[model samples]
Structure formats: C-alpha cells, structure tokens
Target chain A: MKRMSMTMVIVLLLIPMALFARGVSEDVTTLTIAGRDGAYGDAMELAIQSYTAKNPNVRFELLKLSGSELMEQSVIELRGGTGAFDVILIDDPFLTQLQEAGWLADLDALYRKKGVAIDPDLVENMVNIGRYPYPNGPLYALPHVGNVALFAYRQDVSRKYGIEKFDTWSQVLDVAKKIKANEPGMAPILFRGVQGNPIVTGFLPIYWAFGADILKDGKPAFDTPEALNALEYFLELAKYAPQGVTAYQATQVSDALLSGVGAIAIEVWPGWIGNLENPELSNVVGKVKIAAHPGEVKRSSSMIGAWMVAIPKDSKNIDAAFDFLLHLTSAETQAMISEKNGVPPTRHSVHKISSLVAMYPWYPAQLDGQISGSIRPRTNYWAEIESVFGDYLQRALVGNLTAKAALEQIQRRVTEIIER
Target chain B: MRNRERAVYSSFFYIVFAPALLIILLLTTYPMVTILYDSFFRYSFVVNTRTFVGLGNYIHIVGEELFQRSLINTLVFTLVASFSEVVLGVALAFLLKRQFLGKRVASLIVIFPMIISTMVICAVWQIFYHYEIGLFNHVLTTLGMQRVGWLTDQRVALASIILVDLWQWTPFAFLIIQAGMGSIPSEIFEAAQIDGARSGQIAVKVTLPILRNQILLVLMLRTLDTFRLFDKVYALTGGGPANATQTLSFFIYREGFKFFNFGRASAASVITLVGVAFLALFYVRRLLGEEE
Candidate 1:
C-alpha cells in the first residue's frame, strides 16, 4: 500500500511537468518584460494591450518595478543567464554599465536581421544614449522616455519683478534675492536638496553651466576653480531655499510649484511637472514657464535623464521582444502613450504633434533640451561618483563643510572610485 | 531488548532531524562562510572581476571616514533607543499589572503601533514631520514658538527616528515583561507587604529583581534590532544633512547593492555582525549571572 501511494504522488507531480513541457512546445509565445512602475508602468501596459490585440498569438508577462529594483533584478538575471526576462528597461545612467558588461543583446544585428533601417523619427540624441562607447557604437537599446532636467519659474512673479527672462545664473540669483525680500509668504527658490541622487541631479546643470566637468579626459575635475565657483554660487542660492529643504524630493518640489508657494524652481523634470497645465491640479497653471537652465560660463546646459528599453542576451523570446520594441517606440505608439499617460515621448514627430504640444506647452523646450542637452559622463562608476559627490555637496549646503573643502573631498573620493 | 529499542530510537531521531539541521546549515552557515570568503577579495559586479586581496578590503573600509561615522551613529542609536524602550516597557508593564476598568482596551491601544506596518507608520509620520504643515509645528505656532526641522536638522534627525522606534517597539518589550510579571508568584508581594514594604520598595527590591532575566532578554533583542537600523533612515532622511543618521546597515546596503562592490560590503557586514554579537553576549552574560 505504501509503495502504491508513493507511486501515485510521483505520477501526480510528473503529470504537471509533462503538461508544462507540452504547453511550451505549443504555438503560444509569452514575452516577459522587466519595466518600471508608476506612470511608466501604465504606459507599458497600454502598449502591451495594443500589441497583443494586433498579434493574437503573442502574450506578455510584465514585471513593474521601481528604477533601482529594475536594475538589480535585471543585472542578476542577465548575469545568471536565466533567460527569464525578454525585455528590460535601463535607466540612462545604468546603460553604460550593462552595455559594457555585454549582458544586453546586440540591437544592430537584430535590425539587420529584420531588414529594417533604424527610424529617423526617433530623436538622434535620445537614440545615441543607448549606444555604448557612446556617440557611435553598436546599438543595444532604444529610447523609451525622453526625460530632461529643466528650470521652472513663476512667470507672473518674474514679470512682477521686472525680469523679462533669466539668461544667466547671476540673473537667477538676483531674482531669487528679490523674491526672498519681497514675498515673505512664498519660498524664493526650490530644488531637491536631499543627499545622493536627488541632490546630485539638481546640482549637475549648474555645475556644467559653470564649466566644471565631473570627468575631464577620464579623470576627476572637481578640484578646479570652476567647481569652486559653482559650489559657492549654489550655497548663496540655497540660503533662499525653503527650510528643511535637505529632505525634499520630486514630490516636495512639485507640490511647492503647483501650490504657487514657490517662486522659482532651479531644477524640474518632465515627468514631475506634467500636470502644470491642468488648473484642477495646479494653481499656477499657465503661470509658470519651463525652460533650459540658465548659463554661467557657458550656454544653457540641460541634463538628459532618459529611460531606455533593451532585450537581454539570454532571452528566450528575443524575436518577439524586438518586434514589440519597435512597435513600442514607433511614432504612433509614442503619441498614444504620451497623450494618455503624459510620458515624454522619444520620437520627434510625436513631440511635434499639435495635440501633444497643446497639452504639454513645454514640448518645444523639452525637445530642444533633448536635442542639445548634456548626457552624464559615460562611466561604469557613475553611480559611485554621483553618491560621493552628492554627500560632500550636501555637506557644503548645510554649512558642515566649506565649498572649497567640499570640492576637494569630492575630487579625492571620485579619484579613488575611478582608480578602484 | 532495551538496547535494541534504544538503537531504534536513535536512528529515528536522526531521520527526523537530519533535513531540518541540513536546512539550517544551508541557510545560516553557508551564507556566513561565503561572506567571510568574499571579504578578502576585490569583487566588482560591473567589470566581472574578482581579485584576491587579503585584508585589503577590511583595511580600506575601516579607513573610510563615512564608515567610521556610520558605526558611531549606529552605536549611539542602539544605546539610546534600546535603553529607553526597555525602561519605558517595564514602567508600562508595572502600571498595567493591577487590573482596572478599561484595562483591556488600554492595553490594546498601547500595543497598536506594534501591530501596524512599519512602512505605513513611516508614511504617517513623514507628514507629521513636514516643516510647514505638520501637526507638531502647527501646535508650536499656536503656542507662539518657532517650528523645528524634525528630519532635516542633523542634530535632531537621529533623535526623531529614535522617538519613532520607541513608539513602535516599546509594546513588544511590554508584552514580554508583562507575561513575565504574571508568571511570578503573587505570594511574594503579599509576604513583602506583611513585612512593611512599601509599593515602591517592593517594585525596586522584589519585582525588578525577579524580572531580571526578562528585562535582559528584551534589552538583547531590542539592541540587536536597533543596531542594524536601515528602514527608518532610508524612508526618513536617506542619511542626509551631512550623514548624521548614516548607520552601518545603510553603508553596507549602499556599498553592496547600489555600487555592487561585494568585497567592501562583505567586510562591513562582518564587522557589524561582530558588533551585534558582542552586544548580545553582554546581555546574555547578565541574564546567566542573574540565574546563578
């Protein structure tokens, strides 16, 4: 009796395994994608629904994760050669690391196999970010989100102060000072001042505009005079920022802008300020102007923070994933996603659509930033460099370290990271 | 016949316990050994490089100023938070020892924070800590005082987090101590009363002496838990305002997951583990001495 029962259990387990094998051999194809959450996830869901409707035989398993979670999971799966994820989203900064590791599929070969030329509708600068050895290399991913950091200010406030336009960092500082002295109830300036990524990203445009490169000829340039000037200027401007700004994030900055409590924001992202035109959500609707950051020693230098989609080299459904990738980035799909979800589109035609441009009044400025913005230095150690630089920068902002001392410390740490 | 039965029992014991013992070894011992081994190398996930550099990772991590700050912050948090929680827990336990009207409902209310999720608690507190619109600042404004930077001020951020921890975990210590108090014989208190002992004297001389083991256990658990502080700092401050709240676990997380520098992260983790073990040993020794 015992032997018979054991045999029964064995057969029951094997039966499911046999059925699963048969199911895999059948015609149905399931493509697994590791993507982002929030509005990006909603956009991916819309695309998936549209594609599966057109191709009835294809199915999808979408894993919506946060940015850091997506990177960690994708890296682990790719490194293990699990063939678990067919498609994955890579944050622009992490693209260099993944591409350099040779974990991503070669999109150039896939394009050749499909006998289709890369579409020019896609913005050239956005597409260039997906290539390793950067500006020119084998294509391994396609731009999905055309995110760029821009400056925002209350147009009415600026007009009241008799400032027509802010063309220089000095002008911005002057306006901030005036707003602080005049408007006692409103915050003069706003930006994410939290340590790590928030503070680093907010500071980059000013740093670049002041002519300080994080890496010059593959070495740390933070100890230079330009860096010192930028940090000093930032410290001066920070005095006008909201109290407890060191804990501020995107939500806080956007809240301050939308509520008409902030007169100017030194840093704003396309995703964060998408509702600025809606009066229901924003009290400052049509009252705020978004533009490229003001220049100091150079022209306005915006920072590109795009998100890209790629296929893993060990994917089981690479062919189907490539087809979905193309469909996902096509002008029509981009337009649909952008109109419905307010996700920044990567295609020029989509950005030029009259309906989208009407909804997002800053489309022209966004597209301009995308075309002429600066990408962070392409280095595998960008994450470490950003963290170290942010720590010291926040220290200076909070009066814990002098600006020159902060720059010196950042220079020393970044040099150590690169050497390691 | 007895010998044969003994042999059979021993065989059955091995058969029943082998799988569990093996699983424990795999889950605990395996990773610990692996971490120890990895600490001696320079492992970069991006470059896919693993270079053996004995003692180099430990030396480098120990020499880092941030690591030193994180260690000191962790120690301060553990000592202050854990000590406060245990003392408050014992006080509450004594207060509730005698039954009164609404005692059951009061106990439930006191333990509410412990039952709720930490993330949810953090979200609620984040709003309460907001500079301009928080409840505390509103009260302060109404009272004609200045608003405080709860999470942004370096000097006060760690204390704010400790308040949150004490609010959430004191009930856990209370529950354990209360149970221990219940298990003690009531006759001892009556006997002390017959000898003219006051309530305060009885609590100090009789009750506390009897609850030594329980209090020590609570201290040990709370200390070990608080020593590895991560979630509160991650959600509240991100170790900001000049790294005032940066703890060892946050440092290890940044090094290991954010940067994927396994060797340095492993070394940091081993050091933290040793520190926690030492703390646990101190409490355990106290408990054992009380028993003796």
Candidate 2:
C-alpha cells in the first residue's frame, strides 16, 4: 500500500510539469488565421499545409467562416482590442471601410521592416484596392482571390441563334430570345436572384453598359434615362428566364449550366465557373465559351470582386502573419492551391501555367476580364445603395411596380442615404 | 454565542447571490443602456467616429421611406402571424387531445418542422414557394389554375413569409397548448357532461376557459418573437419584390451589423424595444390584474 501511494504521488507531481512545458511551447509558435469558407477556405488550407510542411514546429488555427461572418467578427474582435487573429480575410467591398478604420496594418511598413516588396506578378489594380484613399494609397492588404465577373455562353447554342459576336446588350437579348425559341428546355439566360450581392453584381454589367453610373460626385446617379432603359431591357429579357428566376442564387445558376438547362449565364464569377470544364462534374464540358460582358454605350464592363488578406492593426504576431501572407501569395503556393483546391488564381503567371489553363479553358477570358474590369463605386454607402437598388429592381422584375416607379422609389431612398 | 455563525452564513448567501445578480444586471441592462446612449450619436463605423447629435438618427430613421415601410411590415407581420399561430395551435391541440389510430405518427409529423434549423427550413420552403417549378405552383397548375407569383408579388411576399413562419412554429404553440390541456382533469369534463352539456358546449364553457391563460401566454410569446422576423426575409425574399417584407430586425441588421452605423441601428432598435416593451407590460399587467 505504501509503495502504490508513493508511485501515485510521483505521477501526479510530473503531470503538472509536463503540462507547463506543452503550454509554453504552444504560446510561441501557433498562428491564427481568419479566412473565408467555400473555395477560398480550400485555398487557405492548401497554403497552410504547404507552410507547415516547410516549418514543422510552426502551426496554424484557421477559422473558415462565411463572408459576412468573417467581416463582422474581424471588426468586432479588432475593435474590442483582442489580438486574437493574426491574419484576416476581407471582401473587396469592405476593404475601404477596413482601411479607413485602420483595422488593417500598413503592409508598406511591414515590407520596409522586412526589407522585401510585394511580388510584381500581382496586378497593380488588385493591389491598389488594398489601400486607403485608393490608387496611390498606403498598402494595407494583398489580393488573395482575383474574382472578376465574366459572361458565359454555349458555343453550339450561340451558333444556332446565329449570334456571332455579342457587342451590345441588345444583341445579347436578341440572342437570348432566339435561344429560348429554338431550344425548348434550355433557359436562354440565368442570373443570381438571391438578393443583395448576387442580384446587384448580376445587374452591374447591364447598368454600366447602359451608360449609367452608380455614383456621380458622391451622389446616386441611378435616376437617369439610361438607367430606366436598362431596367426595361432587363425586364424584357426576363420573359425568357426560368419561372423561379427571382429566387435563383449562385447554386441554381451553376446547376442550370451544369445540367444543360441554361444556354447563357449573364454573370459567372471565377469561383463558380472553375469546375465547368471538368467532364465528370459537368454535362456541357468543353462546349461553353466564356468572355467579358458585351459592351453597348462603352467598352466591355467587367466587375472585380477581389477578396484580400489583411493583418488587423491589433495583431500580436504581425511579423509571422506577413510571413504567412507572403507564402500564401507566392507563385508556387498559388499554383498548388489552383491544382488542389480550385481557388481561382489572382496572379497573371498562374493563368499561364499549362495545368491550370487545361483545368479552366476560360482562364484567358477571366484574365482579360480582370485586366479591364470596372470595380463598383467605392463609396462608403455602397452597401446601402446596393440594397436599395436591388430591392426596387426586383420589385420591377416581379411586376410589383413599373420601371419608372421603381427607379423613382430607389432614387428617393438613396438620396436620403447619400445625403446623410 | 451563535451570532457570529449567523453572520458568516449571511455573508455566504450574499457572496453566492451577488455574482448572479451582477451578471443578470449587466446582461439585461448593459445593452439597453448602450443602445440608448448610441441613439444620440452620429456614428460612422468606417471613420470609427461618434458624435453627439440628439434625435438626429431618430429623425433620419423615422423619415426614411425604407424604415417607415419596414415598421409597417413588422407590425402587420407580428399581429397576423401571432394570432394565426395561436388559433391554429389551439385548434390542433384540441383535435390532438383524444386518442386515435396513427396518433403517434401524426404527433411526430406535426412537431417535425420545429426540430429543424430555421435556415434549413427556409431553404426547403423557398423551393416550395418558387414560381416556376415549386411544389405550391405545381399543385395549382395541376388543378388548372393560374400560377400565382408567391414570393415575387410585393402584395403577397410578406404574407408568404408569414405562411412559412406559421408552418415552422405552429407546432411550438401546439405543444404548449397541449401541455396546458393535459393539466385539466378528465373529471372536469365529466362533470360538465354529467350536467347535460354537449361536447361543443363543454369545450366553449369549460375547456376554453381553462385554456385561456395558455392561449394568451402563447400569443404574447409569439407576438414578441414574430415582431423581430429576419431570417425568413433574408433567405427567401430578402425584403425584395419591393420593401414588402422588411422587418425591424432586418433594418437593424443592415444599419448595425452590415453597415456598422451604430447610431441609426441603435435608434431603430430602441424604437422596436419600446414597442415590444409596451406590449409585454400590457400583457403582464393584465395577468397581474387577473390575479388581483
């Protein structure tokens, strides 16, 4: 009995010291990254796997969250002065807000201290979005996802409609009508109907092509004759849309394309179109041609939806976070992520990679779109204005109000938001 | 001699209760105080700036078209959905009170919706409410009727959301009413019948009277809950087909969480809080008056 008691006491005494050693090591080497879910999440996983393999002692805790959830958590945590996250993922639309609030550390300062510069392959426009005051503003983030919206059409179907090249919104509509008439089950056009970002992004090309600007001198420019014509044309084209088109979101549009039910998709982001050429995953593989949006009043209008990586201003491990950021945006890491996780590459070099090109035949189109894409007006009220426009636009689409009525309503509501 | 012991025991009681009381006070009162404080500021989330501007946010919110529409939408949704839930719940509970074949299966099916998460339920219902190939439209077309734009029509979008809420949450009220009904003895019904009262008469005179408090309780609970409708609007219509389905919670979510305009969001929230408080206090006072 005495010996057993003595052994038990020895075991108890050793456990605390072991725990102390483990805790001490854990405090120093671990990196916490807040990234997005979906394809972006997959990309982060690949980067982390590669980074950890190189440095065995270093580890990571990745929070894979939805876009809105990631933004809210980053803001709340950073504002609360919790240096809990070393790196954060931000949507392009929220970059201005993050930059203005100083939630993100200045990447230029980090680079100067590290004696390194941002890699040249990352596009200038993409890098510019990560800055405050934009363009020549201080670098605060890096482009992680090069999301630019492109147009997609079935090669065979477009031929049947005798639509050789879409140069105008009117031509696209003409093609859509012909496709619907010729093809019985296939929808001529499909767009995201799930409201907010989906609907707003889907309509942006048409809105821009109509020669209507979203903002003019810090005021809503939606109340115009061009905007009205665009709405009418959109509604006219809606006749050929599927019956439940109002409720159609990204999943529905993608499903419509993959199942051979949709001939033309007006808005196809890189993330959603990455799997289009995979025969096992797609029914219409190798049959679709993707291009930038057709131009009308101006040049082809493409919208950028870049997702960026930024270190919160309150980060405890800014040095380690910048190290991970560099590794994540490396050409080597980008290529691996494209291959394994199907994250759309942001760098120009990745598009030239033979393997990735083979994976996405639309890589050339996506590249062109990114090169010439027009980003949404970077107003602080973009979120509110987008909501207002999307709501009324759908209202008109559903025949709840006339185009005139809808535009007037949106104008009145948006005027107040901008005025404030 | 034991006075010192009594003092120690009293101190222990204070120590134990103090923490819980403090926590409750912070949880319940802190948010309310913050909202009240923030409503007076011109809050800009991007600038990370707040300025004192008394009644400015309130004036802005009340003057905005979107806010006005959302207020009306919330008020209508709360009254209609809550009343319907209570009436339907009580009706179902009355019918379910008796023993019958397949009663167990019926009960299970009735409670199935409440078991699922709101997002999942909204997804399923969204498909059902689809205009082209939805189950609801499918049924209508099969009967040689015109297809109704269930969610696309602004006039009907709010009503459609209420319909979905009813489907998912009626079971909650039903369960509550059923528990309340079970507590009333069989002897009460027997005695009423022994006095030559018909089943209908017994239900009207006795069963309803006994279940009045439960019905009111469910109504009060559901009214307050429905007043904050958000998830369904988000998943389904997104306050679209016009601002026909915007609710107070959605307004606050947009201004606060989405845009981080703390002042405006707080102003909107305070209005809702005041409205809900008025209703809750009314019901509580009525309950207390009945007791008195």
Which candidate leads in TM-score? 1
Tens-digit lDDT string for candidate 2 (A236-261): 98888887777777888988888888
**Where in model 1 is the C-alpha error above 4 Å?**
A1-25, B1-16
Please provide, for model 1 over A326-366, each residue's C-alpha lDDT reduced to its tens digit, 9 standing for 90 to 100. Answer: 99999889999999999999888988899899999889989
- Summarize candidate 1's per-residue lDDT along B1-292 as a digit string, tens digits: 9999999999999999999999999999999999999999999876679999999998988999999999999999999999999999999999998889999999999999999988888888889988889988889999999999899989888999999999999999999999999998989999999999999999999999999889989999999999999999988888977899999999999998889899999999999999988998898888888778
Error of 2 at B102 (Å): 3.6
Supply the DockQ value of model 2: 0.53
Model 1 DockQ reads: 0.72
- lDDT score, candidate 2, position A295: 83
Candidate 2 Cα errors over 4 Å, as ranges: A1-28, B1-19, B146-148
TM-score of chain A of each: 0.94, 0.95
**Ten contiguous residues minimizing lDDT sum, candidate 2 chain B:** B282-291
